[model samples]
Target: GAGVSQTPSNKVTEKGKYVELRCDPISGHTALYWYRQSLGQGPEFLIYFQGTGAADDSGLPNDRFFAVRPEGSVSTLKIQRTERGDSAVYLCASSPEAGGPLFEQYFGPGTRLTVT
Candidate 1:
Protein backbone atom coordinates (compact mmCIF):
# COMPACT_ATOMS: atom_id res chain seq x y z
CA GLY A 1 0.00 0.00 0.00
CA ALA A 2 1.09 3.59 -0.55
CA GLY A 3 -0.02 4.56 2.93
CA VAL A 4 -0.30 2.74 6.22
CA SER A 5 -3.23 0.34 6.41
CA GLN A 6 -4.74 -1.29 9.47
CA THR A 7 -7.21 -4.10 9.49
CA PRO A 8 -10.37 -4.62 11.53
CA SER A 9 -10.98 -0.95 12.31
CA ASN A 10 -13.07 -2.08 15.20
CA LYS A 11 -12.66 -5.31 17.14
CA VAL A 12 -14.86 -6.74 19.85
CA THR A 13 -13.51 -9.67 21.82
CA GLU A 14 -14.06 -11.58 25.00
CA LYS A 15 -12.10 -10.50 28.06
CA GLY A 16 -9.76 -13.49 27.92
CA LYS A 17 -9.43 -14.11 24.24
CA TYR A 18 -6.44 -13.61 22.01
CA VAL A 19 -6.36 -11.27 19.07
CA GLU A 20 -4.04 -9.96 16.44
CA LEU A 21 -4.15 -6.63 14.63
CA ARG A 22 -2.33 -6.13 11.39
CA CYS A 23 -0.47 -3.25 9.82
CA ASP A 24 0.79 -2.73 6.32
CA PRO A 25 3.12 0.23 6.12
CA ILE A 26 3.96 2.51 3.24
CA SER A 27 6.38 1.21 0.68
CA GLY A 28 10.04 1.75 1.51
CA HIS A 29 9.42 2.91 5.05
CA THR A 30 11.94 1.17 7.29
CA ALA A 31 10.58 2.28 10.61
CA LEU A 32 7.37 0.81 11.90
CA TYR A 33 5.75 1.49 15.25
CA TRP A 34 2.76 0.42 17.29
CA TYR A 35 1.04 2.59 19.82
CA ARG A 36 -2.03 2.44 22.01
CA GLN A 37 -4.37 5.36 22.51
CA SER A 38 -6.94 5.39 25.21
CA LEU A 39 -9.91 7.70 25.10
CA GLY A 40 -8.95 11.35 25.33
CA GLN A 41 -5.26 10.54 25.52
CA GLY A 42 -2.37 10.63 23.08
CA PRO A 43 -0.83 7.56 21.50
CA GLU A 44 1.60 5.73 23.69
CA PHE A 45 4.41 3.96 21.94
CA LEU A 46 4.27 0.18 22.29
CA ILE A 47 6.96 -1.06 19.97
CA TYR A 48 9.13 0.17 17.13
CA PHE A 49 11.01 -1.82 14.57
CA GLN A 50 13.89 -0.54 12.54
CA GLY A 51 14.25 -2.73 9.52
CA THR A 52 13.86 -6.27 10.90
CA GLY A 53 14.74 -5.72 14.52
CA ALA A 54 12.78 -4.16 17.33
CA ALA A 55 14.47 -0.91 18.24
CA ASP A 56 12.25 -0.46 21.22
CA ASP A 57 9.48 -2.28 23.01
CA SER A 58 9.46 -0.30 26.19
CA GLY A 59 5.86 0.78 26.09
CA LEU A 60 4.22 -2.63 25.75
CA PRO A 61 2.06 -2.74 28.87
CA ASN A 62 2.83 -6.32 29.81
CA ASP A 63 3.78 -9.76 28.62
CA ARG A 64 0.29 -10.17 27.24
CA PHE A 65 1.13 -7.71 24.47
CA PHE A 66 3.63 -8.33 21.73
CA ALA A 67 4.49 -7.29 18.18
CA VAL A 68 6.77 -8.30 15.36
CA ARG A 69 8.00 -7.12 11.98
CA PRO A 70 9.83 -10.13 10.63
CA GLU A 71 10.09 -8.67 7.13
CA GLY A 72 10.28 -5.04 8.19
CA SER A 73 7.44 -3.91 5.95
CA VAL A 74 4.45 -5.55 7.60
CA SER A 75 3.80 -5.93 11.27
CA THR A 76 1.32 -7.36 13.71
CA LEU A 77 0.38 -6.64 17.29
CA LYS A 78 -0.89 -9.56 19.27
CA ILE A 79 -2.68 -9.52 22.56
CA GLN A 80 -3.21 -12.50 24.82
CA ARG A 81 -5.66 -12.94 27.66
CA THR A 82 -7.10 -9.52 27.12
CA GLU A 83 -8.79 -7.57 29.85
CA ARG A 84 -11.38 -4.82 29.79
CA GLY A 85 -8.67 -2.28 30.46
CA ASP A 86 -6.94 -3.46 27.31
CA SER A 87 -9.61 -1.83 25.21
CA ALA A 88 -8.15 1.05 23.24
CA VAL A 89 -7.20 2.18 19.78
CA TYR A 90 -4.16 0.39 18.47
CA LEU A 91 -2.34 2.67 16.11
CA CYS A 92 0.32 1.86 13.59
CA ALA A 93 2.73 4.44 12.27
CA SER A 94 5.68 4.50 9.97
CA SER A 95 8.57 6.79 9.25
CA PRO A 96 11.44 6.88 6.81
CA GLU A 97 13.99 5.82 9.35
CA ALA A 98 14.55 4.86 12.96
CA GLY A 99 16.15 7.76 14.76
CA GLY A 100 16.85 11.44 15.33
CA PRO A 101 15.50 14.22 13.06
CA LEU A 102 13.89 12.65 9.96
CA PHE A 103 11.52 10.46 11.95
CA GLU A 104 8.15 12.09 11.59
CA GLN A 105 5.54 9.34 11.63
CA TYR A 106 2.54 8.87 9.39
CA PHE A 107 -0.36 7.21 11.24
CA GLY A 108 -3.06 4.71 10.37
CA PRO A 109 -6.65 5.13 11.52
CA GLY A 110 -6.16 2.52 14.23
CA THR A 111 -8.03 -0.58 15.35
CA ARG A 112 -10.41 0.06 18.20
CA LEU A 113 -10.38 -2.98 20.50
CA THR A 114 -13.28 -3.44 22.84
CA VAL A 115 -13.40 -6.27 25.33
CA THR A 116 -16.56 -7.34 27.02
Candidate 2:
Protein backbone atom coordinates (compact mmCIF):
# COMPACT_ATOMS: atom_id res chain seq x y z
CA GLY A 1 0.00 0.00 0.00
CA ALA A 2 1.14 3.50 -0.72
CA GLY A 3 1.98 5.90 2.08
CA VAL A 4 0.97 9.52 2.37
CA SER A 5 2.44 11.68 -0.37
CA GLN A 6 2.64 15.42 -0.87
CA THR A 7 3.09 16.96 -4.30
CA PRO A 8 5.58 19.52 -5.58
CA SER A 9 8.07 18.66 -2.85
CA ASN A 10 9.15 22.31 -3.06
CA LYS A 11 7.33 25.50 -3.98
CA VAL A 12 8.69 29.00 -4.49
CA THR A 13 6.40 31.93 -4.93
CA GLU A 14 6.35 35.64 -4.58
CA LYS A 15 4.77 37.44 -1.68
CA GLY A 16 1.07 38.13 -2.11
CA LYS A 17 0.55 35.27 -4.54
CA TYR A 18 -1.71 32.32 -3.98
CA VAL A 19 -0.61 28.70 -3.77
CA GLU A 20 -2.19 25.31 -3.29
CA LEU A 21 -0.43 22.41 -1.66
CA ARG A 22 -1.78 18.94 -2.17
CA CYS A 23 -1.71 15.75 -0.12
CA ASP A 24 -2.71 12.19 -0.83
CA PRO A 25 -3.30 10.01 2.17
CA ILE A 26 -2.77 6.31 2.47
CA SER A 27 -5.55 4.13 1.12
CA GLY A 28 -8.30 3.32 3.60
CA HIS A 29 -7.07 5.90 6.08
CA THR A 30 -10.02 7.90 7.23
CA ALA A 31 -8.15 10.62 9.04
CA LEU A 32 -5.78 13.16 7.56
CA TYR A 33 -3.83 16.08 9.01
CA TRP A 34 -2.00 19.17 7.77
CA TYR A 35 0.82 20.89 9.56
CA ARG A 36 3.36 23.67 9.09
CA GLN A 37 6.93 23.74 10.32
CA SER A 38 8.94 26.91 10.57
CA LEU A 39 12.65 27.18 11.00
CA GLY A 40 13.93 25.98 14.35
CA GLN A 41 10.54 24.71 15.46
CA GLY A 42 8.48 21.56 15.40
CA PRO A 43 5.57 20.91 13.11
CA GLU A 44 2.53 23.01 14.04
CA PHE A 45 -0.88 21.54 13.58
CA LEU A 46 -2.95 23.26 10.91
CA ILE A 47 -6.00 21.16 10.29
CA TYR A 48 -7.47 17.68 10.66
CA PHE A 49 -10.06 15.97 8.56
CA GLN A 50 -12.07 12.88 9.24
CA GLY A 51 -14.07 11.54 6.37
CA THR A 52 -15.09 14.36 4.06
CA GLY A 53 -15.34 17.06 6.67
CA ALA A 54 -12.87 18.91 8.77
CA ALA A 55 -12.86 17.57 12.31
CA ASP A 56 -10.51 20.22 13.71
CA ASP A 57 -9.27 23.38 12.00
CA SER A 58 -8.46 25.46 15.04
CA GLY A 59 -4.81 25.58 14.16
CA LEU A 60 -5.20 27.56 10.97
CA PRO A 61 -3.22 30.74 11.44
CA ASN A 62 -5.54 33.16 9.72
CA ASP A 63 -8.25 33.67 7.15
CA ARG A 64 -5.72 33.27 4.37
CA PHE A 65 -5.28 29.60 5.06
CA PHE A 66 -7.85 27.02 4.11
CA ALA A 67 -7.99 23.28 3.46
CA VAL A 68 -10.47 20.82 2.03
CA ARG A 69 -10.84 17.06 2.00
CA PRO A 70 -13.75 16.61 -0.38
CA GLU A 71 -13.64 12.83 -0.73
CA GLY A 72 -11.76 11.99 2.48
CA SER A 73 -8.69 10.61 0.75
CA VAL A 74 -7.16 13.65 -0.92
CA SER A 75 -6.74 17.05 0.66
CA THR A 76 -5.66 20.42 -0.60
CA LEU A 77 -4.33 23.29 1.43
CA LYS A 78 -5.03 26.65 -0.14
CA ILE A 79 -3.34 29.85 0.80
CA GLN A 80 -5.15 32.96 -0.36
CA ARG A 81 -2.34 35.39 0.05
CA THR A 82 1.20 34.23 0.41
CA GLU A 83 3.56 36.04 2.73
CA ARG A 84 7.17 35.79 3.70
CA GLY A 85 6.01 34.61 7.04
CA ASP A 86 4.28 31.74 5.33
CA SER A 87 7.54 30.30 4.09
CA ALA A 88 7.85 26.96 5.79
CA VAL A 89 7.63 23.24 5.32
CA TYR A 90 4.05 22.07 4.99
CA LEU A 91 3.55 18.54 6.27
CA CYS A 92 0.81 16.00 5.74
CA ALA A 93 -0.05 12.98 7.84
CA SER A 94 -2.62 10.24 7.85
CA SER A 95 -3.81 7.59 10.24
CA PRO A 96 -6.18 4.68 10.21
CA GLU A 97 -8.43 6.50 12.62
CA ALA A 98 -8.91 9.83 14.28
CA GLY A 99 -6.53 11.07 16.91
CA GLY A 100 -6.26 9.15 20.13
CA PRO A 101 -3.70 7.37 22.25
CA LEU A 102 -4.04 4.20 20.20
CA PHE A 103 -3.52 5.20 16.55
CA GLU A 104 -0.29 6.43 15.05
CA GLN A 105 -0.01 8.94 12.23
CA TYR A 106 2.19 8.34 9.20
CA PHE A 107 3.88 11.45 7.89
CA GLY A 108 4.91 12.37 4.35
CA PRO A 109 7.86 14.31 3.06
CA GLY A 110 6.92 17.94 3.50
CA THR A 111 6.31 20.46 0.73
CA ARG A 112 8.66 23.32 1.31
CA LEU A 113 7.10 26.66 0.44
CA THR A 114 9.26 29.71 0.04
CA VAL A 115 7.79 33.14 -0.43
CA THR A 116 10.30 35.36 -2.09
Candidate 3:
Protein backbone atom coordinates (compact mmCIF):
# COMPACT_ATOMS: atom_id res chain seq x y z
CA GLY A 1 0.00 0.00 0.00
CA ALA A 2 1.10 3.54 -0.66
CA GLY A 3 -0.15 4.77 2.67
CA VAL A 4 -1.74 3.45 5.85
CA SER A 5 -5.26 2.13 5.41
CA GLN A 6 -7.76 1.22 8.12
CA THR A 7 -10.92 -0.73 7.54
CA PRO A 8 -14.50 0.14 8.50
CA SER A 9 -13.88 3.80 9.02
CA ASN A 10 -16.98 3.80 11.15
CA LYS A 11 -18.16 0.88 13.22
CA VAL A 12 -21.17 0.58 15.46
CA THR A 13 -21.29 -2.35 17.81
CA GLU A 14 -23.34 -3.26 20.82
CA LYS A 15 -21.69 -3.13 24.15
CA GLY A 16 -19.97 -6.42 25.05
CA LYS A 17 -19.51 -7.37 21.44
CA TYR A 18 -16.17 -8.09 19.85
CA VAL A 19 -14.71 -6.14 16.98
CA GLU A 20 -11.72 -6.38 14.73
CA LEU A 21 -10.19 -3.49 12.90
CA ARG A 22 -7.61 -3.87 10.16
CA CYS A 23 -4.68 -1.75 9.16
CA ASP A 24 -2.48 -1.88 6.11
CA PRO A 25 0.67 0.14 6.32
CA ILE A 26 2.91 1.44 3.63
CA SER A 27 4.76 -1.20 1.74
CA GLY A 28 8.21 -2.14 3.05
CA HIS A 29 7.76 -0.28 6.32
CA THR A 30 8.99 -2.26 9.30
CA ALA A 31 7.48 -0.45 12.26
CA LEU A 32 3.75 -0.51 12.95
CA TYR A 33 1.83 1.12 15.76
CA TRP A 34 -1.74 1.20 17.06
CA TYR A 35 -3.31 4.09 18.89
CA ARG A 36 -6.64 5.14 20.33
CA GLN A 37 -8.16 8.60 20.36
CA SER A 38 -11.16 9.66 22.30
CA LEU A 39 -13.12 12.69 21.28
CA GLY A 40 -11.14 15.88 21.86
CA GLN A 41 -8.12 13.94 23.02
CA GLY A 42 -4.78 13.36 21.37
CA PRO A 43 -4.00 9.96 20.03
CA GLU A 44 -2.87 7.55 22.73
CA PHE A 45 -0.33 4.89 21.89
CA LEU A 46 -1.61 1.33 22.20
CA ILE A 47 1.03 -0.95 20.83
CA TYR A 48 4.16 -0.83 18.72
CA PHE A 49 5.69 -3.63 16.73
CA GLN A 50 9.09 -4.05 15.22
CA GLY A 51 8.70 -6.82 12.69
CA THR A 52 6.55 -9.66 13.99
CA GLY A 53 7.16 -9.02 17.66
CA ALA A 54 5.44 -6.40 19.76
CA ALA A 55 8.15 -4.10 21.05
CA ASP A 56 5.74 -2.28 23.32
CA ASP A 57 2.23 -3.00 24.49
CA SER A 58 2.29 -0.95 27.64
CA GLY A 59 -0.23 1.56 26.43
CA LEU A 60 -3.06 -0.85 25.85
CA PRO A 61 -5.85 -0.08 28.29
CA ASN A 62 -6.52 -3.69 29.23
CA ASP A 63 -6.26 -7.31 28.23
CA ARG A 64 -9.31 -6.88 26.04
CA PHE A 65 -7.21 -5.04 23.49
CA PHE A 66 -4.77 -6.94 21.32
CA ALA A 67 -2.98 -6.34 18.08
CA VAL A 68 -0.74 -8.30 15.78
CA ARG A 69 1.59 -7.62 12.90
CA PRO A 70 2.24 -11.01 11.40
CA GLU A 71 4.45 -10.15 8.41
CA GLY A 72 5.75 -6.81 9.64
CA SER A 73 3.32 -5.29 7.24
CA VAL A 74 -0.43 -5.48 7.72
CA SER A 75 -1.78 -5.47 11.23
CA THR A 76 -5.05 -6.14 13.02
CA LEU A 77 -6.51 -4.82 16.22
CA LYS A 78 -8.94 -6.99 18.12
CA ILE A 79 -11.16 -5.80 20.91
CA GLN A 80 -13.15 -8.17 23.10
CA ARG A 81 -16.03 -7.37 25.41
CA THR A 82 -16.27 -3.88 24.10
CA GLU A 83 -17.87 -1.38 26.39
CA ARG A 84 -19.61 1.92 25.89
CA GLY A 85 -16.53 3.62 27.26
CA ASP A 86 -14.55 2.03 24.47
CA SER A 87 -16.22 4.09 21.80
CA ALA A 88 -13.47 6.02 20.13
CA VAL A 89 -11.23 6.17 17.14
CA TYR A 90 -8.60 3.51 16.63
CA LEU A 91 -5.63 4.79 14.69
CA CYS A 92 -2.73 3.06 13.03
CA ALA A 93 0.62 4.41 12.01
CA SER A 94 3.77 3.04 10.47
CA SER A 95 7.37 4.08 10.15
CA PRO A 96 10.16 2.79 8.03
CA GLU A 97 12.01 1.46 11.04
CA ALA A 98 11.68 1.09 14.78
CA GLY A 99 13.94 1.96 17.72
CA GLY A 100 15.56 4.98 16.17
CA PRO A 101 16.18 8.44 17.52
CA LEU A 102 14.26 10.08 14.74
CA PHE A 103 11.28 8.17 13.42
CA GLU A 104 8.30 9.70 11.68
CA GLN A 105 5.07 7.75 11.83
CA TYR A 106 2.59 7.97 9.01
CA PHE A 107 -0.97 7.60 10.27
CA GLY A 108 -4.08 6.10 8.85
CA PRO A 109 -7.39 7.93 8.88
CA GLY A 110 -8.53 5.71 11.75
CA THR A 111 -11.51 3.54 12.52
CA ARG A 112 -14.23 5.12 14.57
CA LEU A 113 -15.67 2.43 16.81
CA THR A 114 -18.98 3.17 18.44
CA VAL A 115 -20.21 0.93 21.21
CA THR A 116 -23.89 1.39 21.57
lDDT of 1 at 25: 90
For model 3, residues 7-78, the per-residue Cα lDDT tens digits are 989999999999999999898889999999999999999999999999999999999999988887889999
Q: Model 2 scores what on Cα lDDT? A: 0.94
Expressed as tens digits, the lDDT of each residue in 1-116 for candidate 1 is: 47899998999999999999999998999999999999999999899899989989999999999898888799999999999999999999999876676679999999999999
Q: Give the runs in model 2 whose Cα sits over 4 Å from its true position.
A: none
lDDT (C-alpha, whole model) for all candidates = 0.93, 0.94, 0.93
> Model 1: residues >4 Å from true position, as ranges?
none
For all predicted structures, in order, the TM-scores are 0.95, 0.97, 0.96
Error of 1 at 63 (Å): 0.3
Minimal lDDT window, size 10, model 1: 94-103
lDDT of 1: 0.93
Model 3 misplacement above 4 A: none
Q: Model 1: what TM-score? A: 0.95
> Candidate 3 has what TM-score?
0.96
Q: lDDT, candidate 2, residue 94?
A: 93
